[model samples]
Target chain A: MREPISIWCFSGVLLFIYGLLIFASGLWELAHPLLHPPVLHQLHAPIWWGAILTVIGLWYLIEFWPHKRASQPKE
Target chain B: MFPATNLWMVSHLAGMVAHPQSGLIAAITPSGMVRLSPVDLIIIAVYFVLVVFIGFYLKESSNTGEDFFMAGRQMTAWIAGLSFVSANLGSLELMGWAGSAYQYGILATHWYWIGAIPAMLFLGIVMMPFYYISKVNSVPGYLQLRYGPATRALSGITFAVMTILMSGINMYAMALVMKVVLGWDLNFSIWVSAITVAAYVALGGLRSAIYNEVLQFLLIWAGSLLVPILGLIEVGGWRNLEKQIIHNVGQTGYLHMWTTLGHFNTNPMGVNWFGIVFGLGFVVSFGYWTTDFLVVQRVLSADNLRSARMAPILGAAFKMMVPFIVILPGLLALSVLPFKLVAQDIAVQTGQHSFNEVLPLMLVRYCGPGLLGLGVTALIAGFMSGMAGNVSAFSTVWTYDLYGAFMNKKASDEHYVKMGRWCTLIGVLVSIGTAYLVQHAASIMDYVQALFSFFIAPLFGTVLLGMLWRRATAAGGFWGLLSGTLTSFGLWEWVERDPSALRYVALSPDAKAMAQDIFRALWAWVVCVIVTVVVSLLTKPRPVAELEGLVYGVSPIPEEHDDHWYQRPMVWAGVVFAVFVVLNVIFR
Candidate 1:
């Protein structure tokens, strides 16, 4: 049950990508002030994308919402 | 502009409110609250007396580990609900976030409207079913059942880290406030607040803490609520105050953080919509609402699962009401006083604190003594209740999870309870000491929450996969936990750490102006969840039988649940989701 190297790699790649995104975002910031999005646009841009992911994940969860509980477990 | 004498209970309370005409807020406290005034010291005495007495009152119940840890599992729904909400509110929320509200505007609390309230409700109905089906001693134990031991241990340890990090900062903050508001020596204030809270926590464990928290919560609320009411009256009334706010904001909505005006100066944490939703809303709310140990223990300790579920949901309602009392005054402080400090967050300050100085500057400058005492008492109550909750939660983690689980396995229930007392003593001392380390953090609010957020999200990955993924292997689960944490930390230090790193992403103009980098912190959560799941999927699955008990909360009694909560998660979820759409549409 110990974790595999893949999990770590997965984590590492994410960090790298986020760092990568930040690196990319830095290019954006360096461009200087742009128009502020409308209030709703301002709030939901991150949310809509995150929600898309979350809903997809949650959809996976709903399919097995009532999955049976196992009486036996690994200690 | 005439003040409303009806709600204006405290005299001179208006002195601190910001007004364009006025040069400064808290202008009356220009001289600073003189040393431990007899009135301030008396408030301390009354607080100790009531708290200590309650400690003894609940001592009989603390004779067992169950009593110490879960208040003997007999807590009523209302109390548990209130306690859950109150405990989650550390000193920082009142002093720090409120300050943010004051600096920014009312829209900051919008996170509660969209994010927190729904999440709490989701946990209420969605989680209660699973919780009722499984009778676990803790959230991690449930993780062990659904996921595997590796996942269990990972979840347990991560939660403990979260508790320590959060509790540690909370401890630091309360002491800092005491020093500032009471004008006591820093060391003395830290020790006093820590030791005082620890004593009651040790005396009766969660029960004592919970009960004391109720009193403290009410007191704090009274104090928080009093600030703006008194201020508006003193400013000559809301008409004048609104003028100041409209003047300060101009064209932009001052009550909202919607505008991209100066980014760094406002929303310093970069708590834009995404940060609020994903960082605080989804990641923080889901992770904490569903799984945080401090919150879970309170619910589990309740008399019934129904109450347990109701506690958080009810608590959510209470939390939503908070912006009215706490944040409004902060905004009022801005309009009445005019803004000076961006990072003027109370928790960020060290050495010199005058919490009483927040409201009393008005009393000292504009009002009289009688009202000041009442307002001061309320503030103290707010501070102490929050501090007490932290001390209590810390001891539970140390005792039940660390001490009883590892150090003293065979100790009888009585001995376990006694050990909890010792843990409380040590936990308090350490926390007080840890408070000193917090100021050194980048932004006490951002640094600690982000640290926890980076590490904690992987947990969501493991738990979700473990319960839902039949193919999820013990190996995968374990690996995911480790990898998730490593990835989060690695990203935090490497990419997000560089101010220039996230400088490239094309964001709204307002996003670019932010003082702190929000992208990196957001990425940490994303990466951790991804690695945990992928690794779990790629790795081997546990034997179905072995994974059985872990996935579902199976118990001998077939955990009883009311039919009422089970039928309507969709309704709740749908309503909440629709609101999200509407908020965007209307606000758009």
Candidate 2:
């Protein structure tokens, strides 16, 4: 029987996807600044925030990878 | 008058401005406000797809009634713990409390701290054993075991109705927020979110709801954490923020939690320490945290007695940190926002921003496209997860306590599972109906929310007595719960008819509407305890043998065999309590 998927694995993938998108958008904004950027736009919050999310997502993915072995569903 | 009445006026005014029927949507130009870019839209779309995928992924495992309703009782403490807290972390609460913080200052933090932490620890260490060992499917199921079918039925019906109605109110509130913040259509937001929540909850049952709640918890942090971080950085540090607030508001009282709480008139909330402790901390908080089935259902999904007990303690730890994301933004808004935020009515009339817009305003102030989308998605996720929690709990109680217990006792497991699924759909539909009803009348929203206060305090009194005291009779439990609920309702009516009655109910003419709510819960609980003791002594008690697992003294609690001291619920609860005291002291 196939092993049940865990919530951590799902969260990992979604966070990675969102982080990558946000990171790319943050880089693009840095290159081509808007007419009126947000208050703390100079801080490039998106880049750092995206990096943090990516790191956390990657850590979750590696730690909670759904291997073929029979395992309890640990969320 | 009442806070709910104030909310109704706000919601009604927002509805009038946003409703398509009023032709004001075009005039208001919601698109003129914070508009989501393609990146933001993609982020939101991705969230929706993932949640639905999770629903379909968990469908196979949810075939059985136990699996569907209880996640097969196989959740880890972290999963159950996060879900437990996240279930209560609704968008309405996030936004409303942020507004409250803006309006009431640091005093608002009491709801997340004193009003929550101790009660949560009590639930984990004291009450969880009775709930976990009794092997009940729902809170009403426990009532059936402890009291009788009559008490169970009354509790179950009220819970089921209140849950469904509250779900609808949440739905409407979310749509209202989306309209006010993002220029989304009311029906569009309502139908889309309702359909998604209904589909996922129906497909995956409790497991789906629980998993989504965990995910929502993370998303909320991911989305909103930037606000305080950026705001603090912008306005220097915490000390500077305090200076800015004092400079802005012309008072240091807004920054102190306990000092200003000595007198009702000293604090922005117009509530005193006595009300804060006995009324909110003891009665309201315990009632909601310990007995409200919406949260308890999550803890009940824990795999073992140890995990079940640890879940709320873990939740309390995380809950203590929530004010950073929720309340701090409001304080930041008070200091940093360029314009003053008026009351909802004043905002509507004068085209000024209202207090409720603080969170979104802060998000917009700090976040551009990609980040803006994340924040909006977090709000949407909070709303959807809250709706899912309500629908899932409603289905379980409706199927098990109401239908299975009363209507068809001999139904097969498969039949009940099918009924549970149907109940989810029905509950969502009913919620949708209630949303439309609120959009039309708006006043009904106030009354529906008031329904929660009526039952929760008295129910807690009954449940606590039933679990602790062996002599608490079935008749005593039923009468106590009924009278407590009626007393709360009667008090609410009295205050509604005569506004000056707040002086009597809240123990001070100076006490505001918020204080009235706290004292009302306290009085209702007192009335319940007195009536319960009188009736229980007069009525014959159940044999100790029959009450073994249900009552504390008669029942033998299962010993938690932890491998280390760190794993003990008591040690961690003690740690959490110590931190709780320090936080109160620091904030005081």
Candidate 3:
């Protein structure tokens, strides 16, 4: 029997995906700014926020990864 | 263009000034909508895919009735704890309370703090043991064990009806928000979210709903944490924000929680300390936190008695921090937004934004493309999770308390499991029907919310008495609950018929609508207790042997063998309560 996936892993995967997309978008905006950027556009919030999400996602993914040898439940 | 009734209803319920006839044509104009980029769409699409995948993955484990309805009772403290709190953290609540903070200042923080923390702690430390030991599947089941079948049936029927209607309100509110914030069509928003929530909850049952709720909790923080952070940075720091708010509003009382609460007229909320303490803190908070099956079901999914006890404590700790995300944005809007947010009627007439738009407006001010998508996804997740919570609880109560108890007593486990899934779909359909009803009438939303509030305080009185006092007879319980609910409804009607009756209900002419609500709950609870005590004294009591596990003193609590002091539920609850006190004091 296959082990059940932890919610943390699912969260980590989604956060990582979101972080990558947001980071890329942030970099793109930095290169070519929009016609009417929002307030504090100079802060590059998406880049930092995305990076923070990425690091936290990586940590959760590594910490809660399912063990290959076990079929028992994992918290 | 949206109907004037729809905009009026949404804006009115969202705590903006309601003028149903005045803003009919210009309400929610298309030019004001925020268009989502392709990147934003992808983020939302990803969320839908992931939730559906979770439902599919957990399908095999959810075959039995126990597993389907209660997640096989295998959730950890953190998972159950987060789901417990997240169940209440809906987008409507987020948007409405943020608007409340903007309109009423820091006084709105009371709802998250004193109004919630102590009740939640009481649930964890005092109530959880009986709930866990009784081995009941739902709150109604516990009532049946403690009181009688009549009390259980009454509560079960009311709860089942209330949950479904509330789910519909959530659905309609979400669609209305989507129409006002984005350019999304109302039907599209309603159908898509309803289908997604229905599909996942039906496929995976409670486990799917719980997991999604946990994920939604994180998504809410990820999406909304930016608003306060950026707003603070923009306006310098908390000190400077306070100064800016004082300069803007011309009053320093908006920053204090308790000081202005001495007199109703002194505070922006127009609620005094007495109402805040007994009405909100004791009655309304306890009613909602301790007895509401939607949240109690999450705690009941805990793997053990210890985990069950710890879950709400953990939830309370996190709950104390929620005002930072919910209330701070509104305060920031008061200080930092370049344009003044008028009432809904004026905003529609003048093409300016209203107070309820603070959260979305703040999101637009700070977030660009990809970040905007995350924020929007968070709101969607919050809404869908709320629907799922209501639907899932509705299914459980319907199957176990109503159908299984009354209709088919000899059904097999497989039969009940099948019934549960079918009920989930049916519940969603009914909720969708209700959403359309609200979309048409709009005034039904107010009545539906009032209907929900009618049950909670009196139900708490009944449940608390049942659990604590061995002499609380079944007849007493039934009459008390019925009278309490009827009293609440009667009070609401009286106030509706004569607006001046607010002074009688709320105890002061200076008291506002919020104070009236709080006082109404308090009075209903007091009436319930008085009636229950009077009736129980006359009625014959249940035998102590039958009340062993249901009543407090009669039941023998199992000693928790914790390896460490920190693992004790009492220790954590104490720590949480101390912090809660400090927060109230600091804010006061």
State which candidate has the highest DockQ.
3
Question: What overall lDDT goes with each candidate model?
Answer: 0.54, 0.89, 0.88
lDDT winner: 2
Q: Give a tens-digit lDDT track for model 2, residues B56-141.
A: 99999999999999999999999999999999887777888888899989888999998899999999999999999999999999
Tens digit of per-residue lDDT, candidate 1, span B1-588:
000110011111112221112222223233234233343344446656767767776676678777787788888777787777776654445544454465456555654465467667766765655654566667676665565555666666666555655555555554444444444455765666676677778887888878766665555553345455556665667668667777876634554444432342354334466555555566655665666666666677778766776777667667767766666666666665433433322322322222223333332332222223334555555555665665566666655555656577687888877777887787666666556665444244454554665555666666656555677666766676677667666655654566454343313434432222234334544665566667766776666666544454322223544578643334544554565556545433
Q: What is the TM-score of each candidate's chain B when compared with the real chain B?
A: 0.80, 0.97, 0.96
Q: Tens digits of per-residue lDDT for model 3 on B458-481? A: 999999999989999999999999
Select the stronger candidate by DockQ from 1 and 2: 2
The DockQ-based CAPRI class assigned to model 3 is medium
DockQ rank, highest first? 3, 2, 1
- After TM-score superposition, the amount by which residue B45's alpha carbon in candidate 1 deviates from its true location, in angstroms, is 2.2
Summed over model 2, clashes come to 0
TM-score: the better of candidates 1 and 3: 3
- DockQ each: 0.01, 0.78, 0.79
Q: What is every candidate's alpha-carbon RMSD to the true fold?
A: 17.5, 3.0, 3.5
**Least well predicted 10-residue stretch by lDDT in candidate 1 chain B:** B1-10
